[model samples]
Target: MSDWTPAEMPRLDDATVVVTGANSGLGYEGTREFARRGATVVMACRSVERAETAAAELRESTSATLELDVRECDLASLDSVETFADGLAADYDGVDVLCNNAGVMAIPRGETEDGFETQFGVNHLGHFALTGRLFPLLVAADGIDGDARVVTQSSGAHETGEMDFSDLNWERSYGKWKAYGRSKLANLLFAYELQRRLDAADDDLGVRSVACHPGYADTNLQLRTAAESGNPLLKLGMRAANAVLGQDAATGAEPMLYAATADVDGGAYVEPGGLMNMRGHPTVGRSNDASYDRDDARRLWEYSTEATSVEFPL
Candidate 1:
């Protein structure tokens, strides 16, 4: 498949886009690009101050004819996700694009504010709850617009993951990277299953679920995870690696932007088109066989719904 570049993206003037974890890194860069293309950009971030600062920077730099709204939402907490969804539903009649972009990686095993494993809670369940709660607004947007898109961020590390239902929370043994891999794998499975449900229901809600990965981009998430693990050597190595092969966060955002706006089929998984999925341009990539298992996807969907207590109308 041919790779996609930021310059090739379609004009997003009429789209109302929400990007979770929009304070920095790929999320912030994605927000900037959408705003630059004239989409009303909502920065849903855990840090209100940081999000506001980033929004202000975008406003100062771009002459794009779109407004930016920064809202606070901590994906690690279901209550916070609910509040954010509630506020969005109350304030806006519709949302055209929902980008589940914020995520944590390789952090020390720990609990969230809600006492769930941090990786699963924030990376999968949180977005699951948020998307479920916001489905109505998404449908509303589809009623007005021709299409509405939901983009979930997965990772290449998903290839190394296997879901352990018996120890989903890493209760028996918590390995930082493994848990993170499981969470990311869950992301791809969720996207695939969601699209399948939408198709089966023949829903014309104009909502399609897609997944993308920002292949080895230089982002603050890596630094934060390394700091949490107290691994200076790993951090140093990552920094050096990034300096050599990592692309800018703007480049990293290309796959997501393409998935959200490009004329692509539903259920496509996008990633950077470079050597070994490191960094470059955006293209449709292959998902692991495990990620495409219908049985596993359904089981995970059921488990996630039970865990997050958010019911989908499917």
Candidate 2:
């Protein structure tokens, strides 16, 4: 089959989508696209003001005939995630699509509110707990809507990741990039393992799990990282390289939009089509062998359950 594009997405009338980090970057663009397709998009962001601003901008730009709801969710804190999920559950009986797209790139060594390494905690475990908490609503939605999807945002950096469970918190040593890679890898593994559990459950719940990576995209994430590090030279180099190679956030969101709404089978890992899966249109991409290790995935799931105290019913 040919590669999927944003235009291929089905009309999303009556659909309810919750997107983490919908206030900016690819997540914001994805929210706009979904709203343009008639889906009621919920912006689960850390900042309510930013979320409202983004929703206003989207409303002005599109005439897709859908409403937007903006809410607060700081994934770094489990309490915040719980409050966000609880609020969503109280407001909506079901959710058609959940896009776990919020994440931090390389940042200076720091711990999350929960005392875990910042990147891994926010990028992986945060979404993991969020999904688990919202799963009941998702299952209910699938029962009512016929199908539901959960799309986790991973990255190309996962190829270089190794799950150092012994040092997941980086108590002994810390490298920002490596921790980010590990968290992204955790995302992929979590997606696959979630699919497995869902399939094994054999319930009528038609909830499917998938993963996607935005290739080199021009977004605030890169700029913020560089600014925080005070690396003007690296930032200049990135800008020069981006001019030559980086894709826009709209294009970067394609893989995620595809994974969220396409007719493709569950458990698929999607990415861009250009050189080294770095840029271009969306396509099915290869994940590293380590990412496919069922045993490790299961272990990670168990560890996450213990860490977050949120269990997947499957």
For model 1 the local lDDT of residue 65 reads: 54
Candidate 2: tens digits of C-alpha lDDT, residues 250-282: 999999998888766778998898778888888
Highest lDDT model number: 2
| Candidate 1 C-alpha error for residue 26, in Å | 0.5
lDDT of each: 0.88, 0.88
lDDT by residue (1-314, candidate 1, tens digit) is 45577787777777789999998999999998888888888899999999998888888887665479999999999999999999999899899999999999999888988878999989999999999999988888952237789999998889888998888889889888899899999999999999999898855667888899988888888889878878799889888877887788888888898888887778999888887876778888888899999999999999989888899888
After aligning candidate 2 to the native by TM-score, how far in Å is the CA of 139 from where it should be? 0.3
Backbone clash pairs for candidate 2 read none
**Predictions: Cα RMSD each:** 1.5, 1.6
**Reference-based TM-score, model 2:** 0.96
